[model samples]
Target: MGSVDKNPVPYCIVALMVVMMALSYGIQSADAQVITYRIHSDIFTELQDRYPEHAEDYWSSVKKAIRDGINAWIEVNPDLVVTPSHDERHNLLIEWIDSERVWGVEYHDRSLGYRIGIDFDSPEPDEYGASLLNPDIIKYVVAHEMGHVLGMGHSSDENHLMHGVENPKPKNIFDSKGYVVPHLSITDYRNIGGTQLDVSFHLQGYNVHDVAVVDINGTQYLVASTGNEGLHVLDMSNPDQPGLMDMDDSPSTDVWPLEGQPHIVQMYSDGFRVWSLSDPANIILLETVSHNSILDATLIYVDDTPLLVMVSKGLIQQYDLSDPHDARKSGAHHDNFNLLGVEDIHGVVRDSGSTYVLVDATFDGIQPYLIQPDKNPARVWHSFDQVEYYDHIQRIIEIDGSTYRITSTHDQIELYSVKPKIEPSDEDPETELIGHLLGYTVLGVDILEVGDSVYAVVATGPDGILGIHVGDKGAGKWTVG
Candidate 1:
């Protein structure tokens, strides 16, 4: 076990194994002096186990917790600006280790790397294992450890986050007691990161989901999802000031338009609804295609036949929308596991020749299928552990030869050379990270290419419409999202 928890806070006998440090010599004392250190926490089983359930905000919350903890220390000292370590020689690396006796072992020095061996699934009669899931408690633990990194000592105050059982042990209360329901401790940390960009249009705090540059007739329009506001169409004919074109009450989880047909396919509960865009002024609902709570659907024209690939409930089905009303089932892979997730299908992509299809979702990572001549889908590849490592694979977009996957956690966009690995491998494809999209939360993204410029209209929950103009290469232009 580490030293007693330092810097405690408001509590009612909430048992927690908090920030206990084992410091080395030469580190500066955090005595009324501001200190900054780059810190990085590794993702382990303790946090990964909860990823699927909290897929929407899990990774983002982890990012927020560490950053917020640093902010709390800054509150104690005005000059502090401890941030995530990029390439700093002297920084903190909060990591995990194989331990059997203790929840964690904190080893520190004035040197480059100080370790935080986070232990998961403690032995019998230990509830600390589960408490690690709570972000509120995580904040306190992080803040307390941060104090040690900044050169602070143990405090006897039970209200401070830096309080525990050892060191300045005045009176031991709930010494061996574990498990704590951490209250939401509002810290004074206010670093929103440089990712947050200002937007001209006001969203009124609505989490923007889908932002597609719709093509109606010959002009370009923007159809955005405003949470419970169904869908909002904006006249982007004049790119400078986009005017609201129309609004509907279908409240879609995902939406895609039919090729050259002023019609859109919107995924609703238990099915999908077709809305016509013939009159940009009035987006009319044409029909409903009910098939086991359609979680997600995408439009793709196979040769001359307009086809739709949808995942709902526990089945992957393809329908021929060539005749609109009399849509026929063309292909299907009857399986409950490759179906819709807690939300809808995160993303869908198909090969240019339409030979194969790739799908992604919340709990499920990414799955690839081979299109057969009999119109039956065959599983080509799948690996939930690999995909979930980054968080939920909510939406995937294929550009050039690489596939871009956007997850709900921290709104991260990862690019992968997925062609060669269409077949399941011993390991997942090595993905290239395109950095994280700046937003409190995100939903889906559609890749837009205009001449030589490639931009993505991302659906952010709180940050509104974010336009990411990704370059042909490098760390693309990330404005918001």
Candidate 2:
């Protein structure tokens, strides 16, 4: 019932309840580390003075891009906290290194931690200068520097965020083929342990909006938004060679593959469509859940049974998909929580048993609700305020005996482990809370646990996505290694 804010500062205090436990348990800390980032105030001030006509717009655009880049980097590694001041305990600082050329650099101290410096100059009224003001370019620069702070070294892989400046082709944050590759690699997380890694990959070709992964017949499929008219399906069997699968007028807004089933459920601007994919090479249409106002649907997940949960346009809808060929809506709810008075529902995640739903309450923070399938009216079990500025929750998995959630928002990826609330009356539930962080500003995320490791697939940009692996953690804290 309480409103949430976009900044997530309020929730930080509440989240401290869990974060403190995590810190006390030895979650790696970026403490007593002095990181200083000197920004060239003169360059920006000069740009504002010279381009008085469009300087404000240009500066605002670049700042937005930098914010995007920072968000993208955070989606991959949520542990590295970035602050402006040169604090001994802070991990990263954004500094202005040059004023004329407009270049930025990130310096990491093995002893002190991470530091980043950015340079921006007045454009020469040339195409390159104009491009420098472009949002995507600015985002790239911030992402690049953040990568250095996260302990990632420069990479030759052109698609990677750590790729050097010599090759500067902006990667689309979202590509129709599937989730875009992220900037950080498996090795990056291995080096940082449980700390966050700031890295991202560029998306090339296609203005991608959203992405979802579905597994059909042992093969993984990457479903994404293509243009404004249709959906693009990519075979992710091989991470490198991603190809497309064709679908008709169904411009998919979201996709969810029913676990243990051969059908993939897709939400489009027009309505909802089900595809029979028993045969991976060929996907056949099964059913459609049409709603006139279904302009856009963002997130989808499967509950304990065969129910499909979807969030779109500030509303939540549940569908029954017991029969792969037939899908029908069972119930729905509208979320009206907002601090900025903006009606936007960004992300959602379901518990393993599908008995509960964790939703981003936007500016109001994250709220947890208990799902009562049989009850006529759904009930709220417990709702907590000030969880985090969670744009997207990627993966929720139970590692060892604890459940953890991976969340992305505002240039950082955070891992939250559920702490049981002991009650005097009822028995404590056995469920665990686990989620993943992804998206340009940490819009969405998905994660899975295999063997002793956890793999997180995150949306880092409009077409940017990254896969991260967190190795086994002892009883203390969850570490990346």
Candidate 1 residue lDDT tens string, 1-481: 1233332333222233323243434544444243334444355344456445554465566557666655765554444455555565544565554344454454555565444433333211122222333455456666656555554455455655545445643434322112121223422111122232222233434556666655765666677776577888877544446678788866666666566677766765667767777778888777787766566666655566666777666677787776555667788877766454534434444433444456664576666666543387677754433333322234455655556654455433333334346566435555655444222345666554444445556676655665555445323445565
Residue 173 of model 1 has an lDDT of 34
Q: Which stretches of candidate 1 lie over 4 Å from their true place?
A: 1-204, 237-241, 323-326, 333-354, 358-368, 372-374, 378-410, 414-441, 448-454, 471-481
Model 1 scores a C-alpha lDDT of: 0.52
Minimum summed lDDT over a 10-residue window in model 1 is located at 174-183
Error of 2 at 25 (Å): 58
**Structural similarity to truth (TM-score) of each candidate:** 0.46, 0.46
List all candidate RMSDs to the true structure.
Answer: 13.9, 18.2
Query: Best-fitting candidate, measured by lDDT?
Result: 1
TM for candidate 2 is 0.46
